[model samples]
Target: MADLGHSSDDTSVDSREENSSQDSKPEFSEDEETLISRMYNLVGQRWSLIAGRIPGRTAEEIEKYWTSRYSTTTE
Candidate 1:
């Protein structure tokens, strides 16, 4: 028999880490914001399309960002 690097603690801890990561919000840099704005003007509100240009970003997150950043009344 061999240890094979197996451990009960590994599986249990990994599941918790995955769940916590999903709950965390995405972070964007200043450069990313500028790029997003430029891309929006060029491509319009196609979130999935826009997301494809920005690596590691999803359509859902981009939509949320667009709404919060540019879709508000801001009165």
Candidate 2:
């Protein structure tokens, strides 16, 4: 039999706890909210070029921000 190196069962439990802790992080600040909103609006108008103009902004980040904003506004 080949020795397949496997992690202890505690690894899965530890990973789950770590993930839950990460999930409990607080929401973004107002400045982040504004930047995200700007990114989203720009994305809607110019899908290709806006990314280069905004530093540290990605399409996924823009989308997530927009979705969160939309959800909050609608509620």
Candidate 3:
């Protein structure tokens, strides 16, 4: 009989929980925000390029944070 009461991927779940427990969100500074904004103005919607201009943030993270705070489209 299958053990439907528990997932077969219990180890995966446990590792995910452990990793999540150790993970911390990066603290973006006002200066970094200002730089991101300025880069947006100069480059428009280009997240990777903007991230290259800034430090300590991936393009995906920058895009997510920027889009969350500012709803306006880069177009």
Candidate 4:
């Protein structure tokens, strides 16, 4: 058999881990949502800056949230 980076079982385990961690992340407040929106618009998906502007959120979280909420698969 040809080598693949991960086995099917490994893929499934990774997917579950990702989903569980995502589920544990708290929802953004209305003000934080607004800030995210504004920062996104002003900087065009520059998530590090957006995360810097927000008090508690991490850049990775901000990037994921923006991608999930605003970006289409085509983009």
Candidate 5:
């Protein structure tokens, strides 16, 4: 038979390595949670103006948090 590109075992090993790396990363702290909450509350309603109040918060972070919260609440 012709050789396959990769075996199932190789895929399993790659998945495990990726999960292990993700697990090692630091979790967000309470301050981060608060910032994310505030950001989500301000998204779209007042993006440019509210952003000035939160110095370190990013637009992407605000969007993600708002999306996550919206999904959770709708479900």
Candidate 6:
């Protein structure tokens, strides 16, 4: 068998750990949600700026929220 440069056991374990961690992703509080909306309106997708205003949140998280909350579904 050819080595695929990756181990199946390690990959499965890593993915399981990541999935568990993500399953407990913290929710955005009402105030944080409001702040994100206002910031997005003012900054126009500047996620880092929004994240800076909200403590304990990251730019990627803000962006994901915005996308999920506001983005229209296109088939």
The pairs that clash in candidate 3 are: none
| Candidate 1 Cα deviation (angstroms), residue 35 | 1.0
Q: Which tens-of-lDDT digit does each residue in 1-75 have in candidate 5?
A: 223546766788999877854553323457765765676465644544444555665455445544554555642
TM-scores for all candidates: the values are 0.61, 0.37, 0.58, 0.61, 0.33, 0.67
lDDT of 5 at 74: 44
Better of 4 and 5 by lDDT: 4
Clashing pairs in 2: none
How would you encode candidate 2's per-residue C-alpha lDDT over 1-75 as one tens digit per residue? 133334555677799867854552325667766765686565563523544555665555445545555755642
Poorly placed runs, candidate 2 (over 4 Å)? 1-26, 45-61, 72-75
Candidate 6 local lDDT, 1-75, one digit each (tens) = 335545777788899878854853447899999999998889998999999999888898888888877889998
Q: Report lDDT (CA) for all predictions.
A: 0.79, 0.56, 0.78, 0.79, 0.56, 0.83
TM-score order of candidates, best first?
A: 6, 1, 4, 3, 2, 5
- Separately for all candidates shown, the number of backbone clashes (residues 3 or more apart, or on different chains) is 0, 0, 0, 0, 0, 0
Residue by residue across 1-75, what tens digits does model 3's lDDT show? 366535657767999878854444434689988998999999988999988977667887778767777876675
In model 1, where is the ten-residue run with the lowest total lDDT?
A: 1-10
Clash total of candidate 3: 0
Which of the predicted structures, 1 or 3, would earn the higher TM-score when compared with the native? 1
Task: Give candidate 6's whole-model lDDT.
Answer: 0.83
Top lDDT model: 6
What tens digits encode model 4's per-residue C-alpha lDDT throughout 1-75? 334645876898999878866773546888998999988889986788899999878888887777667667782
Off by over 4 Å in 5: 1-44, 72-75
RMSD of each candidate? 4.0, 6.6, 8.1, 9.2, 8.7, 7.2
- 14: Cα error in model 4, Å: 21
